[model samples]
Target: MHKHLLPLALLTVALAACQPQSQNAAPADSGKPESATAAQPSQADRAFADLSKRWLEGWLQLNPINATQVGDHRFDSEVDDLSAAGRQKALDFNKKLIAELDAIDAKQLSRENQVDALILRNQLQGDIWSTETLQSWAWDPQIYSGLAGGAIYNLMAREFAPIPERLKSATVRMGKIPELFAQMRENLDPARVPKIHAETVAKQNNGLRELIDQFITSNADKLSGDDRKKLDDAVAALRKAVAEQQTWLDKTLVPNAKGDFRIGAANYDQKLKFSLNSALSRTEIRQRAEAEMKRVREEMYGIAQTVLKDKPTAPEMPAQPTPEQQQKAIEAALELAYQEHPKRDQVVDFAKETLAQATAFTREKNLVTVPNDPVKIILMPEFQRGFSVAYCDSPGPLDKGLDTYYAISPIPDDWSDEQVESFLREYNNRMIHLLSIHEAMPGHYLEGAHSAQFPSTLRAVLRSGLFAEGWAVYTEKMMTDAGYLNGDPLFKLVQLKFYLRTISNAILDQGVHVDGWTREQAMELMTKQAFQQEREAAGKWVRAQLSSTQLPTYFVGVQEHFDTRKAVEAKLGDKFNLKAYNDKVLSYGAPPVRFVRQLMLDQPIE
Candidate 1:
């Protein structure tokens, strides 16, 4: 889903940093010198803790925007230095951390510590690969625009402190906007940039101005005279910087952009390892995705025939339909569902209503432990739009009890009436229910609340993207199994469509990045095979090109989660409780599914 739109700096912080917690002081030395008689923590455990602490400190210093996002306030007034020297320093820091991790003896550590060490080591190595080898800074303009938008967005979006104090901190960050843009210019080589990256950044650059105007200018009454004046100046400077960046992107970068959006087979494989945090390779993911895509489409065909049986669009009921017949049946069935969507202005209200119903269904059916933490349904922030249509913005692990936003983007005003209709049909009423289940109840919001309660702050912050997205997808099926919508086959039909979407996501990700699939090929897979609306397919095509290795998370993650639960059910038999199993899996926090599997079964984590 590409849930995050922030730069790698902020993302590194979100994925790596834990809030600083007070540790017990070393015991006073006994009269006798410490000896082997005194039980000591394993050396490996000590090394892991030390390395984690030092690495976090260094990371926060290097990427302050991330620090702020994780509720670390010391660096709130600072933005990362994106100069070439700064990048090199970050690269060196990662190398040093990787070396330290390599020295740790994982075999000597307890199972939990061993897993933590493994996670940290892989994360550090991945960072080094991305920064030094991938060199996205040299080519991706989103790196700069994301930094700019996130700097202000993080500050103003949360009320961790008094508004005035945060606003004052924002002024300091805004003061550095020009310098940040200057570094961006020095770091980005237009000749190496991708046209799509430049084009996207050109649009997102305007978001910086929109953010300031919406958050700061609109709330001028909340600021003191000095704060307001500083904000005004900062906003003007940021606007100028944004305009210059757009000019550079349109004139210099886009024209000369010669780099390929595809990361190629080798890069895609390496990045997939880090992104998926799974044992599956790219080849394996494609195989599984292709098989699943076929299976899900067949299931959708059966349901479509059931729902659309007297309609002329309904295909003959058989195990195998001709490709054309299969496509027609799925589209006709989906069109029926599309007839039930909300009007444009009513979309947000409809989502809120669906969320309430989903929450009740979870409680009534006892599908899983439903957290009492409140989730607010809001319009997607302007700066954060243009990516996914909806996202579950959970609070940082350090900031427990804050609101988790289930933000949905409104229809853009510039869209033609036809495009709007296509989009609404794709996100039809039944689909919105599926989305609410995935984004709110027993999905990201529920899992995230449980993740916040894990004893290890490190695990909480380093939650796996695969596990998060996978669990959301898994919950959709779980809810359907629990007889959501009173056991209507129509609901199951839509659920299968979403499953197809997830499977097709993996296929599209690899197809574009590794197989060199063109836009037409990708669109055909989405619109025809997956039965996506034209607008939805087009957006996904852009998303697949704009990012890599991310789209596969849903398919891979869900499969791992499903396999884990099946294994647990086999072992426990009648002793297995659905609520307990779900609670227990989530209680481990959002680690890789393989790690979660080991923890659940009391096996050594490899």
Candidate 2:
């Protein structure tokens, strides 16, 4: 499953490696006749360096499965602990890492090294705050026991480790599942889990069960007799426990789920700072979004008026759905879209064509220096289920070759004809071009190419999620501004529709999780504000519940980029080459746009 969406900039799981331990004693100095100034790169500095490296190594070890997924095979022999002790160990480790990173002299390192230090420091800080304050462990299904079990199993299936070692770890981890489930069943306070998040977990647990069954069924023939017997027994136990867990989830967990879904006044404020590394509060974000929404809506309305000037009643297209017709209309719309899907290969080839086109277009316009070798798009695998139409898989910094998987998740075979149509209506042909520009071509792929070449190891490791996603989001609009539509009205309309998605994502993510919004509220907003197809709107509602504030970055990031570009244009005057500006901006790796802006303006990175 290519769950990792933003290269290393997304969240990470690390393969552990052993390093020399730092001595525990603090540095001391003999008394001097006169007070001595602190020495440069002093003993304390050396201690900080040693501790920081060890902490990084430990983080890698804690996430063996994630490491393997990203091509780091060293931790393939271990599965992480989610037990009380495990959680404590994780906490202690993070705290120590934070202290060590803090002790270092940020100014002493190279500029790239300084950025690396900042990224490491920031990730740890964000992790600590989001966890300790938010206590996502209490609510997030993605980190729940069942999901972790599936992650471990998926890693084993990859077969990246030595056979015996892999089997031994798999067997041990498999055996531990019954206990893990027991712990989860006992420890999870149904009352504490948010209702939507709990429901999502139930849905995800169902998916995990299929993975367990598939694991046993797929590997049954390959295992040795005893190994097969152990795995078979393990699978049976797991399936039964998962089934029992599912019943509990439905009966107890779901029904009793009572925590507030909305992050609300306080937490939303904290999350904005954590997820975005920005001081902008939820209120501020909402204000900005509301202003943009009104401005954009009026502009769109003006465009609408131009097209329908003679018709008095044609102020805007009414949804025209009576109570009974609403669902019917939605179903009809989806069915039409699904029927029009390009053959699967054609979809892949479409991505390729867009990449080539984007590359040539950028070069001709001197938009930015394109990488010599870029990422390639591939089809999404069955193991990774139900995400938006497409996403980009970026190269890990440790991995040399720049391979991009432009994963397109086509309609499932079992989807009803109507269901497929509804999906496609939301992603009409022009919208597809906009999506292509964002995910491949001059968006994610381009940003990734530039990011990979950044000189700092730390920056590479801690690339900003906002920058990556934001660049892609910004590109969709930038291309439109640069005359990408070829004068097609429908294309322009779809582009605005897609931009509405970015806007809607920001508001809905905050609304659902932080404002205690209902599905109906989110649905109405998406449909009315964004003019989204209902089915598509429904999926966004679910996605917002599963993920957190992440959806807002696209709108926020794109706006920041646009603001930066405007500032640069003013300063550079005639010297402002778009290509030079872009190349220099991306070359610093994925810093927050403000940080990138500061660097572009030759200001310190406070």
Q: Ten consecutive residues with minimal summed lDDT in candidate 2?
A: 15-24
For model 2, residues 1-606, the per-residue Cα lDDT tens digits are 123422111233221111111121211111111112343444543554465456546665665444444444455545556566766777788887888777777765544444455656767876677556776666654455433554555455443344455555565566666565665666567767778777766766666565655554565566777877876776777678778878887888889888765666577666667667654567777888878876665555444434444655433334443433333333333233334444433556665666677667767666667766546665554434444567766645544453456778766677777766666667655666776788876787677767756543345545676777778877777677777746554455566667878888888887887678888899988987777876688778777766667788788888888888899999999998877787877877676677888767776766
**Number of the top-ranking candidate, with TM-score as the measure:** 1
Which regions of candidate 1 fall more than 4 Å away from where they truly are?
5-40, 310-313
- Reference-based TM-score, model 2: 0.79
Q: Among these predicted structures, which one has the highest lDDT?
A: 1
TM-score for all models, in order of appearance:
0.94, 0.79
- In the range 1-606, model 1's lDDT, one tens digit per residue, is 425534353233243212223221211111111222255667776777777777767766787776666656677789988787888898889888898788888898767777777777777878788887788777877777777787887777766777888888888898897888888788888777778887777777778878888777777668867778887887787778788878887888778888789989888888888777798888788888888888888888888888987866565665678887888777777777888989988989999999999999999988788878878998887766777889887766554366778999889999999999999999989999999999888798888887666656566656788888899999999999999989888889889998899999999998999999999999999988888899999999998988887888899999999999999999999999999889989877688899999988988888
Summed backbone clashes in each candidate are 0, 17
